[model samples]
Every structure is written in structure tokens, then in C-alpha cells.
Target: MNTQEQTQLNMLKKALMQSQYATVIAQCDDVLASLTSPEAMREARYCKAVAYRLSGQPDLALHDLQQLVTDFPDYGRAYQEQGYCYQRQGEDQNATYAFYQATRFNPALLAAWQQLEQAYQRDNQIRALQLAQQQISFLTSLPKPLLGATDLLHDGQLFKAEQVCRQYLQANKHDAEAMMLLAEIGMQLKVYSDAEFLLESCVTLYPDNDRAAAAYQALLSKLGKFPQAVKQARRRLQNQPHNMTIQAGLAHALVGVGALNEAIELYRTLLADQPARPALWVALGHALKAAGDTVGAIEAYQQAARQAPDFGDAYWSLANTKTYRFDDAMIESMVVAQHGSTVKLEDNIHLCFALGKALEDNKQADQAFSYYQRGNALKRKTLRFDISRTEAALEAQQQACQAPMFAQPGGCHAPDPIFIVGLPRAGSTLLEQILASHSMVDGTMELHDILGIANSLSHQGNAYPFNLARLSDAQCQALGQQYIEQTRAYRNGAPFFIDKMPNNFIHIGLIKRILPKARIIDARRDPVACCFSGYKQLFGEGQEFSYSLRDIGRYYIAYEKLMNHWHRVLPGQILTVQHEAVIDDLTGQVKRLLAFCELPFEQACVDFHVTRRVIKTPSSEQVRQPIYRSGMTQWQQFEAHLGPLFDVLGQRTNR
Candidate 1:
């Protein structure tokens, strides 16, 4: 209340308003040091704590809040601030308790109610819905909407959600929730400019709303304003020191801006508390790996596995990490455990495929083959297109590829590049790893560049058949140019790059015409084994192809027929790397593979895993180890369970 104290307080407030959090923190600290009156000191401590929290120093903020509550239990704001700090630290239980205390002291504190609801939602407690409903009811009885138009935005109905929010905002033009909701709706619609405007409005109107702050930070991140995002995240964390979500968001922004060390520190702090969160563990593991702390990364992954035993990602990472090692018993055990535990046939197939890789890594060729076979068997049952239909498509594609190119002249672009195409989980990734290890070859896993080009060329009015042969010579040339340009992004100036889009099997004809200089490598496994493997693996997104068994099998059969046709027409243009053949003659096959790619043999190529390169594939772990023979015959163990698959394979015995 004195002039000097008032001056210091005003400076702190001004610093916060300008988002100069560090200055605010310093000002608060100076004022606190000079305060003598108990009431004034309490106020100064609160301000300092707020500043600390905002500066990404939540532990210090929590300490101040805790001391304030201990000294004055009736302080509602202190309880609310303490709850926020606890939430940021991911101490949900403590955060809930603190929010309850805040509500008990001041029932009308809507921020406390909102924080409590978020805590419940984060924990996935059913009571969260009831609490949200209660908050909504309280607002409904008010003459004016205290929040904004966007407060009415619900899940599942985007258009209706927007309309409700807009109507609410029309009635109360100054509603922060409505502005925030409009921003959210804009973000959803990919209208970044609109969203940014609304978020800015919300921040200006409701400076105290941490949700607005969080949203503003997210918008800044979207706009590539990482420094601003980091600043905002730090400030928001001060308001709620314990919140893991805020910490994670801040860490992500830091990582985006290449501040790996800082991000690592933040992740490490988060992990120290909730060491069991698989996502946090995975993120920390990735950061440590990027920092070249392989041992530390492994330890983090192991801890993640221990915490969430059924988490497939942890096991997958572990399996991949050990794929090149001579002893992959741990990988085998995890894969087998995964296979045994999951009732979904697809899950088992993926486990079997991984098991095959682990077995191969361990030099168990016969067992590896069996596992590979089992994976393929499962795959055959789920494909969408039949063998006959695929064969017909392949015939058409071959004819198209063979047709003379008169438009651009120069002998139809000269197919000089090698492509490894197949359905996913059919040893395509493994094959790419092996070939990429060669001195003259570079492997680019599953690039979308080629497919995107093919898609554009195939567009003829409304009737797009998803068939490659439907495209013309001119279209193919244009597509080929697009593919080359797109792939230029991934090219490390290597002589040869592998375009291993598994679905590129569908566009072999288009690829041949566009890059007539490209060679084609079809990575084939037994249909049953491939199909089964496809069934078992869980893709993160955009694999609508794996939703059913029969669809997968048909897709495989179609791929096989096309590959076969390409072989007959293009002849030596396409090389077949049978999964079994590769396993049977590792050295001989690799030498042959090197000859095909016109690369001089190197002993180092045989031990490819030791060569460090950025591997962006699911098999990153497997490629790190030396070659082994474990994956040769892994299907026999699950023979009883694969009757349908076996029947289909039985009919294809002639092939």
C-alpha cells in the first residue's frame, strides 16, 4: 500500500501484461525482499510465485504457493494457484485436492471449477462429464454468458458446434469463450489466419484465462512462432506448475526449434515425476537418442515397457533396437508375448512378423521362415482384390509400360532406378534396409512422392479407377517429373535411392514410364505370412487398407500378379527378392543384389547395421544389428489357427 511497494507492484503488472515474464519475476523478487508487513509480504510472495510459474520455473512457484497456503489457509487465490502448479507437474491427485480447497473457500471461483473439470478429464474419470454439465448449468442461469460464444462448442458436430458458439457470441459480443471457440473452429477448418485473430482477441479480452493462454501458445506453434510459444508455455506453466500437458507442449515447441538440450531437460523433469507415462518415456527416449545417448534411450524404453507391459510401441522399439544383435531373446520373448496376448488375428500376425525378424536376427533361419510364412498366411485372408483380377490389371499395366513413348522422344526416359514394392509387413522394409547398406545405394522408405504424382496423373474427370494403366504417356512423363522433384527432398546426393512405397506395386506401370531409368525390386513373401503380418501390425494412421482380413489378402494377390507380369514383360527390369531366397542365401543374394545395383562389393555392406545413417522406417531397430537366419520358417507354430490362410496357400501351390 506504500508508494515504493505500489510502484514495484505496478511494474510487475506491466511486465506481465507485456508478456515480459522474466522482468516481472525479477520485479516481484525485489518487492518481496523489501516487504515487512505480513499482508503485504503475502501479496508479494503470490506475485513472485506467479512470475516464477510463468517463467517455466514451476517448482519454485509451487514452493511459494505452498508457503502462502500454510500461512493463511483461508486464502482462496493461494489454493487456486497451488492447484494449478500441481496440475502442471502432473500431480493430478494433489491438483484435485487443491482445486477442491479453492472451491470450498470460494464457490463462485469458475476457474477452479474449470481446472477441476480438466483434471478429471485428464484422468478419464466419468465424473468429468457431470462436472462440465454442472458448470454449464451454472452459466445457463446467468443473464449474460460469463464465458464466450465458443463455450457451447461440443464434440462430434463441427458445423452445429460452430453455429451454437457463434449465436452465443452474437448475444454477448465480449464473451472470451465465444472468441476462443471461434478460434478453435477456425483451427479445425485449417483457417489459420482466422484462428490467430480469434485467439489474439481472446488473450486481449481475458488476460487471466490460462485456457486462452494455452490456445494462443498452440496457435503460435502452428504459425512457426516457436519463440513466442515457448515464452507463453513458460508463463502458463507458472499459473499451473504441475501440468504435464503444458510441459509436454513446451518441450515439443523447444524440440521443433532445435533446442534439443533444453527440451531434453524439460522431458527429464517430467519423467522424474510420472516415469510411467509411456508417451513421456517414448518422447524422452527419442530426445536422448537424438542427443546420442543410446544407452540412456534404451533405459528409458525399458522403463516404459515395465510401466506399460501391453504397450506395443515400447516392445516394437525394443525389438527394433535389438534387431541387428546376435542375441535377440528379449525381442523374441516380447513378440511371442504380444502374439499370445492379443485375440485379434492381425495383432498376432504383426507379432509373428516381428518374431520372424527377431528370430532372423538370432540366426534361427528355419524359425524365422516359419514366422514369415505365418504372417503371409494371415495377410492373404484379409486382402481386397483377388489374384485373377490382379493378374488382369498387371497384364494391362505391362502392355501400357511396353507402349512406345512418342511425345518426349529420348527412348521413354530410360528406367534406371530400382523400386522395392509390396504390401507392408511383407519384408519390404527389411529388403530396403539390406539394399540401402550397399555402398552405391541409398534407401528411402515408403516415400509418398511417387504415389502423389501417380494420383494426379490418373485423375480423368470424375472416373478415377485407381488403376495405373489408365494414365497416358504425357501424364506419365509429368508424374515422373513430379516424383523426381518430390524425391529430391530425400536425396542425400546418393547415386541410387530406393522408392519403397509398398503400395507402389499398384503403380509399377506409371513408375516405369516416368523414370524409365529406374529398376524395380519386388519384395515378396508367402501370401499367408505377408497377410498375417499385415493383420497383426498396428499402423498409426491412414492405413484404411488394413481394417479387414479379406481386403488385405486380395490386395496382396493383386500385388503379386502385377509383379509377375512386370517380370515377364519388363523381364530383367524388375528383380524379385523372395523373402525365403534372401534368408536361404544371405551372402550370395546380397552379392547378387549389389551386382544388380551396379555397386562394387564391400565387406561393410554385409554388416550394414554398424553403418550409422538416419533410418526413417519401422524397422529402425532391426537394421542396427547384423544379419541372422531366424525368420526362415516361423509359421508352423500357429498352423492350427491359420486354416483359412493355409487353404488359400494350398490352392497356390503351383506358383
Candidate 2:
């Protein structure tokens, strides 16, 4: 909502409290008509419902509340208001259930907690009563600012919550809970290094705080520090031997570090005791997929669907194989599950993406696009991908990375690392597989070392690329060596290794400053094909731009412009490998790639499909098979629906 709309909304709330029901409903309708944001629409409906109830129209109020919760199942305020409607109608059981849902969605809802506490106590539910009482007591005991911030956070006002929490933390230095709240805010804001520091300090200051320890472990996993995540998870498991959640987290970290066999075993052991858990089944499927056991992965995914027909992640996991096709019955099940009143927001998103892929595989192009659009629309809600921020960073790179920065002999002379940089779905993984097939090259999953270094620099008051200008040659050399040491764990006694983090295209200037002797390959693909492919795939994390077609299109344009700038300032330093060219002439492309990297051409590089390694990208399965023409022209079918993508791209390949 805009400033005027927000002010009107506040006024409507005041009118509602003053018993001006008609005024509240009319103004809410006006606000709803003007408000385009999903959050604003929900707020308007919620206020209107309260107005209906206050004006003695219980049926209308219940109708509105039902629709509100139906559309947004996780709307805790709707649930709380629905509970009130039920309570007014003397429907005690319904009111209690609605209150339960309210608290389930938002534990910070004080009114909901108090109601639940009363309901539990009256029903003689001792355990439940104690839990509710504890929640109420804890909430009431918090400092007023923190309590307000908690409410704002739960209500999706992240910026406001951050501002309030930061203010509170400024006053209450080193308060564990305050630090935790700030850390949470930082994470939501995508300020990872700050969150890491806050959580790390919290854990160090209060060693006994398992909550802080667990948060730190989760962050480590998120940042792709798998070995550290493994250590953190193991420490937690030691403290709580039977904690299945921690063990499962450890299994995840194990998988991250290419310990697939061990991770698979751990998942199997967990499933053995909890066979009914669909999440365990889904997670097991991921490990199996990464281990190249496509058949086993399918079985695990199918079993998960069988266990819970409504489990969207299970269906999405199956579709993510890029080889699986959903049968009619499974599609029907998915459609039913998605429309169910209690389908979780996360589950709904999975279902949309899963359905999109399934329909696409079945050759229903228009229908597939519809689901893809819905999936992207839903995913966009939870992200913080600012295309402008990315563009600004790229602009800074162009301005800072002049020819002068590269004149001196600076960075580490280690020529071991080969960096494959590009957008996701631009064939970086395929190139990595081909290169790693060579005798001297090792294949590593997308490494966060460079991004982490840039993030660290940005956090230390000097942002990346800009920071490069101030660094002496010695400093650059030290950073370059630091990267080598950081990535040593992923090497297999090979003279060269591939860091195929696609988004590293944005950090070419940073990579140059640190690793001057490193081989840089730009994995180029058709603009339409690359953007559409990214839009369809459900990546585990990062690449937030993929959630929207226009955002991704803009990102690609920004990347292309940056690459052009890099080439201008550092001529002949980067090689561009076009995906289509590679598909058309594999041998010629292999020769070209090998020549650029100064490696001997080998038959194994041409036969990359037979090269065995831990591949994790969406194209992993496809790359395991021989090169095919299908991927090259797959975007054509969705050409009619590509306007959103192409609108941002000034030109598109002839359809």
C-alpha cells in the first residue's frame, strides 16, 4: 500500500474500534480496490470481516474469514478473527480449533495464546495449558519494543521489525534474544555475514544456548560451509543423542560434502524408524538423485507420495528428476491437494512448480506456462531479490575494475582453479563435467568461496570490486592464497579444479583481483532458452531472480553487460563457450575449451557423459546421457508465453 492507503487503513481501524461499522466496511472496500499488493488486500479483508462481525452480521463475517484463510492458509490474523466469529456464535469447539490454528501459524499472537490458554485450562488439558501459559508468559515478559518488533516480524513487516529490533539491540547490547532477533532480520534481508557474526557472537557469549548453536549450524549449511555445518550438527547430536532433526541436518551436510553414501545410510536409518515421515522420504530421494541412482530416487519419491498424497515436496522431487513424467492419477491428486483449504504456502509453491514441469513434460505448453507463472508468483513473495541492487553492484564493478588494477603482477600464481561463470541453466555444469573428465582437472560442486570473500569484504565496511582498488598486491596475493586454502578440501590431488558457481559471472572483477592466473570460462546460452530454463527449475537456494521472468531477464542483461565490460578491461583473459555451439559440434567445442584452458585434448572430455562425479544441478541427469538436441530447442514450445521474459530482453532469437 502507498502512504495514503496505509493512512486510510489506520483510520479504518480506528473507526472499527469506535463502533463505526458502516464507515469501516466502506473504507475497507475503497482500500481493497486501491491496494494491489497481496498483503494489503489481505489486511483490507481482515478489517472488513471485523466490521461485519461488529455490525451483527456473523454469517457475513464468517464467510469473509473463511475465504481469507482459504486463500492464505498461514494468515494467523484471519484464524484469530475466525475464532472470534466462532466464539460469538457460541461454537466452542470450532473456536478452540481456530485458536489452535492461529497460534500454530503465529506464536507471537498474544490474544490467540491467551485464548488457547483459557481453552486448554477449561478443558483440563494440563500439558497443553502449561505450554500456552508458558508462551503467554514469555511474550508478556518481553520488553515492549521487542514484543512489538516480534509482532511486526510475524506480520511480514520485516523492515519495520528490523528497525525496531536494531534500536532495541543498540540499547541492550549483547542480549542474546535481541541479537537473535537482529540476526533473523539480517537473514531475511540477505545480509548473511552480519547474521553469521551476530549468531557466532551469541553462541560464543552463551555457550550453553542450544538455540543459538542450532541457528549457527543452519546458517553454515545455508552458506555452503558443509564441513563446518557437519561439525555443528554433530556437536548438537552429541548433546542430544536421539534428536532426529539434528541427525537429519547432519545427513544434509554430509551430502553437501560429497559423503553421499554416508548421508544415504543415515537417511535410511532415520526412515527405518520413521517410515511414515514423507519429509524423510523426500530427503532420501535427493541423496539418491545426487548419488546417480535415478531408479532408487524415483522409488523413494513415489513412496513419499504414497505416504502423503498431499505432500507437494514429494511430487516436486519426482518432477525435479527431469526424466520423470506424472501419470494422470498423480496429476489429479496434485490438483486436488493444491486446492485443499490447508495447503501450506511452501507446499503450494512446490505443487505449482511440480505441476508446471509435469505438464510441460506432457507437452501441454500453455497449461504448463500457467502453472509456472503461478509458481513464480508465489515464490516471489518470500524472496528479497532486488534486480536494481544487482545492477548497481555490476555498475560499481565496471567503474572500479579499470585497466590499471590489472597492470601489476599481483595475485597468487597458483594456476589450479578453473572458474566457470554464467547464469544458471547456461550450461556451466555441462562444461564442468567435460573439463573434469580431463586427467588433470577435478570437478567441485558450485563453490561459495569467492562469494563469501566478497560478502566478508562488504561486511567489513568496504564492498567488493570497490574494495579491490585499495588492496595492495600483497593483500590480493594473500586473498588469492586464502581462496586456495579454503577450497583445498574439495580437491582430489588434481593439478586443476573447476569452480562452476554460475552467479560468479557477477564477480569476474573480484576473481581477477584475487586469482589473476585462474582460468575463467563464460558459459553462454541463448537468452530465451537460459531465462525460460531458469524459470522452470526449482533450485534449493540462491538465484532469487529465477522466481520472476522479468527479474531474471534483467539479471541476464546485466550479466551480459558486465561480461562485455570485463572483456574490454581484461582482453583475452576470459573465454566464452556458447552452449548451442557445443551441442552442434562437441569435438570442436571440446578442442576449443581445452585449448583455452591450455590443457591437452582427450577423448574422455568428449565423452563427458561417462565421467562419474557428484553432479547436483537440475541438468545433472540430462548431462549423464549423451548430448541431445531437445534442450537446444525446448524453449520454442513456450514461445507464445515468453512475452514477460522477452519484454526485458530487447531482442529474442527468431522463433
Candidate 3:
């Protein structure tokens, strides 16, 4: 290679390391065009392909990798790259074939073996463990016992796996997998510092390992260092440009940092390359919806559903797009029937609840009630909670709020927020839509900011128990400020914001402590009705609470107890919004709700359907329609079927 060529190559390499994908591609393209030596030409093409992959252009990367392997048949790395590209494109068979070829060409390519294992895992093939075992057997000299620990870890035995990893690290302290396993264990245990140190070591030892990079970025995100995580993800993408996982991580980081437009662009590019990836399509739909392009978002979700018909996420996304309650029953039925045969109990519950709401909205009260009963039966088996454990915490929080330990000295300068708290199916979403329609309020559906702050504080030893009374006055004030700051990212200078996480009922004590001045609305419904409603819907993530009926009933009881406690301790701090009452007197209830929120009544509040704000809840369809009486007294028809739940709910039955 000439001096000029070497310099140009060096510059291209630097660009690739920096994740300047476009610059690297341009440099490589020029280098390949001018290359005289066959070796140099092949190398340049490979570099170009890497750059293209990093830039979220997987098809171009695949084309280049395929041409490289064809021309340089003995190049094992070329085959490995081709396999990875194929995997990203969901051509699992082709990916496996390419990995096999790479292994045949070079038995020492452990990365190819790992990729093969992942492809099998993705396909949920039982033979994946056997394949991994086979690959482990091929290693002439095991680097460390950590390899075995990884095998156990991958099989889901975290405690045993971590023990094995710790044993391995005692002898060989520098084992990257051992370090990473420790990190995983730490994360699971909520030991942030231990996880961070272990991840940092793993990344340092194996900079080219995309898994290590991803883990590091995840830890960073968990620690609330989103910008740094984004930077690290971008850097990793430079070398593994065609890496879909990294692309997704980058998009998520961008969203975390409020770089929505850039995240949208990156997601679009990823979707264009891997059009059939339902998760990617769902993400794109969310990004588009957040960007105020509801039509575009709906189309994206529909395309996702068409590509992966059984994917629960796509159905959930579709259910959240329609502009009227009239379509709610149809969407719910479709989702339920689509996933009915599976053992996914939560999805069944979610769908049933959705169906009940839809039927009630359509004035098919008898059918809705039947579904509501089925839903409640399922919930009683699925959802569970410890009321005694939570109530103690609520009492403590009430005392702290009354004592004014954390009250802002000059009085709260922050905007008053209308917080909607309940179980998922208790009409919190609808309340937010009505409130958001008023000129003084902006409904930010189910903001994670409050929960994120609470979680962080809990992890940081702030001495605040899960219940309210345990919080010191100072701690409560700090929590409030932290919540406001975190939510500032989602706030668009609106006078008031609605934090409508149904599960936020669990944190009502802490919420009252922090935002004593804020208005809280407990969206109450018949216990059987609410539990049943939660049974038929399919939540895509983090809903371990809805997998069984007993759990659901227990959860409801805990929520109710906490809400009742709030009423006793923080009188006038909260208002009760009955879902049935809303149905019976839409305008009157809405007027009262507006008065509670301290917002002037506007005609828009009654005609909330005309507002173009993005709705992120399962009730999105219902909220976009005008008020109706169909949802009132919806549990009557299923009275025979829901006897057990009715018995449990007892005198608390709102009906």
C-alpha cells in the first residue's frame, strides 16, 4: 500500500471507530474505486459494508458481505458478517447456513458460534442448547470456567450461574464473560455500582463485543445517563453498523434524551431494512405517534400486524389508534381471538377488558357484562398484592405530608398536576382525555417520570418505604422536585400535566408527600368489573402483576385500601371519579372533574374527541369518541359467572 492509500485507509478506520458512518462509507467507496491490489480492493469493500451496516443500511451491507464471501471464498470473517446481516433481515435459515460455512472455514471463530446460538434462541429452537454445547466442546483450551457459567446463565439459572461466574473470577479475574455475568447478577439484584463496574471492565476487555456494548449502554440508561448511553451506542454502531440490536438501543436512547426526530429517522431506516420486524415497526409507530403523525403511526402499526400476525404488541398498538369507541369491541375481539389459543393469560385478560369496554360503549350491556365477568374471573387467578405491607407505608406518607417536612419554602411554584391513579382498566385514560381537552391542561399519557424517580430514590437508600408515612419531610420534598425535573423532559410548557399511570395507585402516598398541592383522582369502578377488565387486555411489557386471577383481585384490594387510606388522611387532596358516573352524566361529571383540576370549563372538554393529542392507553379508541352511556352497569349480565369475584368484592361493589 502507498503512503497516500495507507493514510486514507487510516482516516477511514478512524471514521468507522467514531461512528461517522457516512464519512467512513464515502472514504471506503473512494478507496475501493482506486484500489489496484486485489487484497486492498477486497478490504475496502469490507470496510464499506461495515460502514453501511452501522448507518442502518442492512441491505447494502448484506450485498457487500455476500459479494466479499463469493469472491474471497476462504474468508471466514466475510461469511460471519453475511450471517449476521441475514439474521438482522430475519432470514434465519440463510443466517444459520452462513454461520455454518464460517465455522467450517475457521473453527476458532467463537463469535460466529455465539451468533448461531442467538439465531436459534430467537427462533425458540430447543436445539439451541445442544448447539451451544457443541460449540463449547470444540474449544481446544477453555479460557475460563466462565464459559460454563455463561451456558448456565443463558439457560435462566441466574443464582447458580452467578455463583459459577464468581468461582471462575476468583481464579481468572480478567474473564470478560465472568465480569459480564456478575454485572447481570448485580443488575438483577439492583446493585447498580457493582453492575456498572463489571460492565465497564467487560467493555474494556472486549471492545468489539456488541453484547458488552449493549449491556454497558443498558446500565448507563438505568443510571439515568441517557446522553452518555446514546454516545456509547453510536460508537458501537460504527463497527457493527448493520447491528439491529444496537440500532434499536440507539433509538431508545435517543427517545430517552428527547431527540425524538433523530430517533424517528433511525427507526425508519431500521424499518426500511427489516420491514418484517414487528418490534421495530411498533417502535416506529410510537415515535411517529409522539411526533403528532397519528395517521402515519397507525399505518406503521397495521403494517407491523400484517408482518407478524401473532405479535401481541402490534395488536395493542392498533387498538390505541382508532378515533372512536365504536371500533373498540371489534379490535378487542380480533386481538383476543388472535391470541386466544396461547397460554398468555395477561393478553387474554387485556383483550377481555377491552371487549367489555367496547360492548358497553356500543350499548351491548349484556355482552359487555358477560365479558367483564370472564375478565374478573381471570384477574382473580392472576393478580395478587400485599395490602398490609402497602398500607403501613401509606400511613407514614400521610403523616409526613401533614407535617410539611418537604414542602417548598415559598409554597409550590410547580404547576398543579391532575394525577389519575387506579388499576389499568378503571377509566384513568378516559379521564385524562377529558382533562387534556381543557385549554389549561396537557394530558401526558402514563408518564414514566414519576415511577422512574420513585424507583431511583428507593434504590438510593432515601429511607422512604413503599408507603407514605416512612418518608421524611425532606425526602418527600426531594422526591417531588426529582419528579418535576424528570417530567420536565416530557412537558411542553403546559399549565398542567396529567400523570396517568394506573399502577401509580401504589405510590399515592409518596405522590401526596411530594406533590401535596396536586389534585389526585382515583378512577374507581366495581372491583369485579375492574379485575375482569384487566384480564382481557394484552400488555406488551412489564405486567407480571396480571398473569393470574388471584393476583389481580389482591392487587385491586391493595389499590382500594391505599385509596381509602388516602381519603382518610389527605381529605380533599383527591377526588373520586366513578367510571359509571362518567357514563351516566358525561357533561356534568366532566364539569366537576374540570372544577377539581382547577381549570375553567371549556366546550372542548365535552368534545374531547376533536382534540388531536396522542393517546397511549388501551382505551385510546374509546377516549376519542363523544360521551355515551353504554359502559354504565356493565357487570350485570355476567352476574352468574362472576359470583366468586362478587363475593370477594362484597360491600365495596359500586353497583
Every candidate's CA RMSD: 19.7, 3.0, 18.3
For model 1, how does the per-residue alpha-carbon lDDT over 104-126 read when each residue is reduced to its tens digit? 55554667878777777777878
- lDDT string for model 2 (108-146, tens) is 899999998889888999999999999999899989998
Cα-based lDDT at residue 627, candidate 2: 91
Give the residue spans of candidate 2 off by over 4 A: 1-10, 17-19, 29-46, 58-75, 86-105, 113-141, 384-386, 462-464, 652-654
TM-score of 3: 0.62
Best-first order by lDDT: 2, 3, 1
TM-score of each: 0.52, 0.91, 0.62
Report the lDDT tens digits of candidate 3 across residue range 1-655: 4666666677777888899999888777677777775556666777788888778888999988867765655566677777878777888888887886776655556787787777677778778657665874755255556555554444334577688878878988777766777888777655666787788888888887767888999887766566678999989988888888988988977766657789899999988887889789888888776655767878887787678555655555654553424364456545556355432444455456556656656767777666655654555433223444444655554444443333334223365677898888788888888888877787765765566555555555445443345555576677777777766655567788888877677666566667767788889886777776665455544444554445566667756766776677666778899988888788999989988877888988888877877564667667766766555554555555555555555634434
Candidate 2 or 3, higher TM-score?
Answer: 2
Least accurate 10 contiguous residues by lDDT in model 1: 148-157
lDDT measured at residue 306 in model 1 versus the true structure, 0 to 100: 74
- C-alpha RMSD of candidate 3: 18.3
